[model samples]
Target: MPLPPTVADLTSFDLLLSVARLGSVGRAAAAHGISQPAASSRLRQLERRLALTLLDRSPRGSTLTETGALIADWARAAVEAADALGAGISALRASRHSRLTVAASQTVAEYLLPAWLVALHAGNPGLSVTLRALNSADVADRVLSGEADVGFVEGPAVPSGLDSAVVGADRLTVIVAPGHPWSRRRRGITAAELAATPLVSREAGSGTRGALEAALGSAPAAVLELSSTTAIKHAVAAGNAPGVVSSLAIVAELAAGTLVAVPAADVPLQRRLHAVWPTGAQPAGPARDLLSIARRR
Candidate 1:
């Protein structure tokens, strides 16, 4: 039987995913064995065929629009399935041949780790890195179970049974849509008031949530809870409610005037970021090198 039009266009979807992962079209072109101009033309043709604007390009990189991100997730699953069918055992071997596995909290993964990975790649040309992004609790769990070589966390305290080093500090920011009532307030919100207000928040078990909970001494009133940072950003920017999130998460939005920060007083708005490994076992090789870099940063 003949395949559907979408099936015939699988390469375009793969190109989309590659650009999304690598952060630029030029890099995606090289990954997919095409020239930069050719990849750009193909992407434009794909959008014309589908009648959709999928990417929002910026000076630094291209980001998927909301509709684009949704479609890309679906496309990624299909691509993985096709990859498994095409490569079979070799794909499994390639996955298992990874040299380093690092688990990190949402804050680090979204904000910091990409730059670090790029630096590591430049210095160690042949090194392969595997990154897992989860909450601090899960990062510690991965380290403890030997599922990860090292883990980066941002929380009030290091988890029990893990040895950790302070790498940096992450400041939490309280943000609302520009037209929200909080944006116009002259004084900082009291901890009680901040806790009482309904907010768009991270799901439970996230390091960002953990830090918020610790500062509030209890749970904040959540009007909506989402697991993805993009989803939360959208909810807040659409005027759902105020949100307390890692400062690094909203730089682009803030610069674009899509969100505004509210002064937060009487709230512990900072948390220490740490690199953790199993108890009695210090990181060696790639893990140790990464840890040193993180500390220096």
Candidate 2:
């Protein structure tokens, strides 16, 4: 008779690897939808069973020790093999009904996803989609936790445990009320000049805010932190302060002359829009189909 696998053998080694990669026990627990203490105890149990330490823990973060690094490499190989088998099985079972849930940052949700959704629906009438609009960080979190089938964000980098591909491009444009000083200037605005002026901005965690911070070297003089792009545009138009926003979001305002798009010497600030999904979870069925539509658009 074959010997039974031990408790350690039954524990998911994949979880351990993911925790190492993400660098925080809390984040890892959230990704798996378990309590932090449970995750910690499991890791300890695994360590005790293996007679090896896998992580160096400090308040700063966790890092894989030497033995952990070696084990992690092997674990990754096993995960790849398992994923391949799972993919083959999933492909075989593709005829079954499956739902796709997608979460997108506010700008993409407001401006881009509706068109993509219409196209996706035309192509796959049988597929159901649930769409949620959130900030970029929340979109990534939902994808990593399996709560969202896919995510679309505009930002600097993909959060750990989620893979992202740039599906489109967008630009951040500085705008002012038609009467503002910069509206008539038309050119010669440097980064320093923009920095010195009081700016209306989105609150922290917004993808637009992240892009602006990256371009401007620090947080702007946020005279007002509004939640919605529409609200920000209204504030700018009321002459509250100059604001930066996605070019797509302010299209109607620009066209109607309610707001003026200021020209900066080197500053049609461009940013890449990304489509993201969990690193190990391949897009399938409706999710795969939607991704294709988004990419083409």
Candidate 3:
């Protein structure tokens, strides 16, 4: 098996993950503060070195191949681990000054952190922020271990050893392709009806999956278990299976008419998004400010 690209060959795994997430080199480049052509050329170079087509380029956008999708997930994990290592080193060097480190689950990291970080910067220009994106369990671990000044999670009760506050709410909604049978129904479907159907669901341990299981009182027969909201949306839009997802994750698809939210008899499967930190510790300055901004948003 040939390698896709060595770490040395790419400036950062951030670029690759961004391309995977956004599905366009131009968008990925812009997110990373680079030029579109530069991003395209780098991806092409990686493809050449691997001797495999990593992306399916179409008029609408780029889509990852099966292998590319798997590789992208691994790359994202590696990149996140690298970031954690760097933050650890920086913390050691700084020793005692005020710095804010946050650990957040994927949904909050992707959809909410950027705006919160922006607000934090504007409110306190002198403070530094380090953000880590992980699953709910890991977020709690980081806060407990003091690796993160604060943690945000989308799942159930906060893990022990941490103090938590509900900063916001997220609703889990069932969605299907616009042409799917469920979309034609004006009346909401019962939980039993949904439980009998095949569904695309987040993998176990995901905040979304946990909330859905709580809402339905049992897991639906999963046709597919995906890691990212984007992949789940694409699978649902292709009519593979109906999906339970955060409404925030599917806003673009719903707006574009690519997917439709199915009305559930138990509407708005509510989940509290919590901001957590050590039980005895207080978050002041930037961390406090970021939490305040997130609540307002």
Candidate 4:
């Protein structure tokens, strides 16, 4: 509904109170950063709109009439309510912009998120961020359920119902102990051999596992399944079975020869990493800033 004309122009009501306090339209106009004539004209319009004279104007000055004084008292409440409303909205915005919660796949959380978070904090000093490391499917669930402000996943396909943007790309490396036969092979193994062989692998919800299955068009047989990439690396190094892990996760081990990367000749091992959020809810505030940092890198 439209506001009543007399009460709609809160500035004029404010000017009336100022005139009552300062004892003149000229003084009120000066206080409100307007010319005396403009202030007088606004007051005239307001009086005509309400059909009530709110100011007694004379060469000496302007004074509030008895009815004008009563109206000013009521206007004070409306003005104060508006001020409170503004303050409340500001507080809500500050809360939203100052805090962020993130959920990410284990590969991203362990290898990529630390650097991105460091950059995010350097730019926004007082922002608070919380992170949860889960498998790719859990990351999507966290975002869709509103338990997290944003999520990062390395799966080949994004979960249904959430929007996503590719933030980075990663390759899944097939790794084995230094003594394994594949480590000594003159050429990379084919996808059929890699799929046919039982391997130590991450649990089903993992992005690494998902990418491998998607690339091979079926799930590979697992000799053992572990949740942590670190654990899988240790198992592979012990000559238990070859395992697939993010290239990022095995950098040091590959350098040390604790694990050797065995490539798949026919399989596409590369996957894109993504930032996911609920549909129609674009990231804002610190979440948006963190995503920007990810994309830049």
Poorest lDDT segment (10 consecutive residues) of candidate 4: 4-13
Q: When superposed on Cα atoms, how far off is each prediction in RMSD?
A: 23.6, 18.6, 25.2, 2.8
- lDDT string for model 4 (145-241, tens) is 9999999999999999899999999998999899999998769799999999999989989999999999999998898999999999999999758
**What residue pairs clash in candidate 2, if any at all?**
none
Question: Rank order by lDDT, top first?
Answer: 4, 1, 2, 3
Which of the numbered candidates is closest to the native, going by highest TM-score?
A: 4
Residue 72 CA error for candidate 4 (Å)?
Answer: 1.8
Order the candidates by TM-score, highest first.
4, 2, 1, 3
Count steric clashes of candidate 3.
0
Per-residue error for 132 in candidate 1, Å, reads 1.0
Candidate 2 residue lDDT tens string, 1-297 = 653443325335776877877877778888889998898888887788778898898988777789988877877876777778889898757643356789998899999999999998887787778999888888988888888889999876677888877889999899998888888885647888887888898887888888888887777788999887888998999975899999899888889999998876664379999999988777877888888988899
Q: All candidates' lDDT scores?
A: 0.86, 0.83, 0.82, 0.91
Model 3, C-alpha of 261: deviation from truth (Å):
0.8
The candidate maximizing lDDT is 4
The alpha-carbon lDDT assigned to residue 247 of candidate 2 equals 89
Candidate 4: C-alpha lDDT? 0.91
lDDT of 1 by residue, 140-196 (tens): 899999999899988888899999999889899999998898888889688999989
Better of 1 and 2 by TM-score: 2
Candidate 3, pairs of clashing residues: none
- Model 2 poorest ten-residue lDDT run: 3-12
Candidates in order, TM-scores: namely 0.66, 0.67, 0.64, 0.86
Off by over 4 Å in 1: 1-98
**Candidate 1 lDDT score relative to the true structure:** 0.86
Off by over 4 Å in 2: 1-97
